[model samples]
Target: MTFENTKEFAQQLDSQDKLNKYRDEFIFPKVNGEKVIYFTGNSLGLQPKRTKAYVDEVMDDWANLAVEGHFYAEKPWWDYHERFAKPLSKIVGALPSEVTVMNTLTVNLHLLMVSFYRPTKSRYKIICEEKAFPSDQYMFQSQVHFHGYKTEDAIVEIKRREGEHNIRLEDVLAKIAEVGDELALVLIGGVNYYTGQVFDMKTITAAGHDAGAIVGWDLAHAAGNIKLELHDWNADFAAWCSYKYMNSGPGNASGCFVHEKHHNNPDLPRFAGWWGHNKERRFKMEPTFDPVQGADGWQISNLPILSLAPYLASVEMFEEIGMDALIEKRDRITAYLEFILQEIDKEVDSTFEIITPADPSERGCQLSVLLHGEGRSLFDYLMENGVITDWREPNVIRLAPVPLYCSFEDMYDFGQILKAGILR
Candidate 1:
């Protein structure tokens, strides 16, 4: 499909877009009395207008029923989280029994590692991508330290080639093989936050298992943004934050996955609490912890219902639209965004390099642009001009044209604003 840097062309694409109506479903911030063109869904998603009702339901229940809301409210607070299992399972391609909603991303990762990251005398190293998100980096450091190992020795980072922006699949596989029996766990972000590269999870998971290591994923960027088959891929465990592509509010509850094969394993270690205990026996308040089977077994405390409310609202929205529809629009709109960037670069005679992989299968909605002659001022200029985007260190601006709410018109408008910012 040929893309033109014109309002008419963008409008034509928008007219044909089945998901275009969803743009109105979200509330966008205004700059100079106009709704800003949003490009930061990869960072924080715009709130759904329906979110208020979900929250209000909880608030109303608390107001009227008091403590009894836990049992008698419309969507009873005690069983509130159970609503997410079916829909979220569909989104991440897992069985309902294999999925649950719980703590935030990094916290869940740490909790999951207690079970998946067991180290031995000879096998204690963990393999992860070089320059992982700072939180994950810190988590790895702390986890290895807790288990009494030096950070440098216990963590094996698969690095990109000097001039390359993305890590090669072969390098990752080779690293797993090289680590061999010494590898205790293979934990990587399914979608790299920096370069927007989507790793080959199925192959990597298989490789990790073959190398005698447990495999897991941090799906913060990949969860709702891409197609995932955690069950079919046979990933031991995975966790993702809902506030990004999932469109839940800030710091919302996270979704988790644990394969059914591990459900019946009573010996698997985890930090447990009353919520994770068997629901039937929970009121009994027995001294011994009998964990609820499946992903719920990993919960450490009673859920924060308010946090789960907005997430349930967003997850239901994903169920309504389905991932196939989202990915179809994602691929086309992201390509359009890339085309617009290229067109703008040509128009401005500026050197703008997209570090994200060109293959549709290797990226999601995000396109990270490396500005050769630009700096922070351009990012500031974009922000002031009603283009809400994210700027990383050096000169890269991350743009995520989220299929749910962002439009082709937004992409074209962003190009015009970008050109103006560069010229100014």
Candidate 2:
């Protein structure tokens, strides 16, 4: 399909768009009394308009039922988290029994590591992508330290080639082989936060297992943005935050996956709590920690229902639209965004190089643009002009044209605003 940098062309596309009407479901912030062209869904998703009803139900339940809400409320706070299992399983490509919602992303990762990241005297090294999200970096460092190993000796980072923007899959596989018997774990972000490259998890997980190591993914950017099959891929575990493409809220609850193979393994280690105990026997208050069979076994405490409410609202939206429809719109809109960028680059004196992979299968909604002859001033200009985008250090601007809310006209209008900013 051809794209044109014109309002009429954009509007024509919008008219034909099946998902365009869903944009009204979200509440967008205004700049200068007009709705801003939001490109930060990769950071914080716009709140769904229906979110209020979900939260209000919980708040009202608490007000009316008090302690009884745990047993008698509409959602039954005691079993509220059970609601996420089915819908979230579909989103992340896992069985309902293999998935659960718990604490936050990093916290869940840490808890999961207790079960998956076991290292022995000979096999102690962990392989991860270089420059992982800062939180993961800190977690890795701390985890190895707690196990009495230096980060330098225990963590092996897969580095991108000198001029390349993304890590090569071959390189990752080769690194896994090189680490070989010493490799205890292979964990990396499924979609890199910096370059927006989607890793091949199935192949990587298989490769890690062949090397006698456990494999997992941090799906912070991939969970709702791209296709995933944690179960089919045989990933030992995975976790992701709900605040990004999932659109839960700021620092909201997280979703997790634990393969079914590990469900019956009583020897698998994890931090236990009353919530993770078997549901029927939980009220018995037995001293033994007989954990719930699947992913719920990792839960450390009772869920925060208020946090899960917004998440439940969002996942239900995903269930309604389905991932197939979302991906169809995501690819087309992202391609159109890239086309707009290239068209504007041709007209302007500045050069805009897209650092993300050109293949649709290798990227999601984000396009990280590496600017030449441009800097933070351009980013500031865009924000002031009602274009809500993200600015990385040095000279890169990240734009995520989220399919649920952003429109085609936003790409055309952003081109106009961007051109003016460059000229100014």
lDDT of each: 0.94, 0.95
After superposing all C-alphas onto the true structure, candidate 1 shows an RMSD in angstroms of: 0.7
Query: What residue pairs are clashing in model 1?
Result: none
What TM-score against the true fold does each predicted structure earn? Answer: 0.99, 0.99
Q: Candidate 2: which stretches are off by over 4 Å? A: none
Per-residue CA lDDT of model 1 for 1-424, tens digit only, reads 8788899999999999999999989999999999999989998999999999999999999999999999999999888999999999999999998999898999999999998899999999999999899999999999999999999999999999999999999999999999999999999999999989999999999999999999999999999999999999999999999999999988888889999999998778888889999988888989999998889888878889999989989999998999999999999999999999999888888678999999999999899999998899999999999999999998898999999999999999999988898898
Those runs of model 1 whose alpha carbons end farther than 4 Å from true positions after fitting are none
User: What is the alpha-carbon lDDT for the whole of candidate 2?
Assistant: 0.95
Worst 10 residues of 1 by lDDT: 293-302
Q: Can you list the residue pairs that collide in candidate 2?
A: none
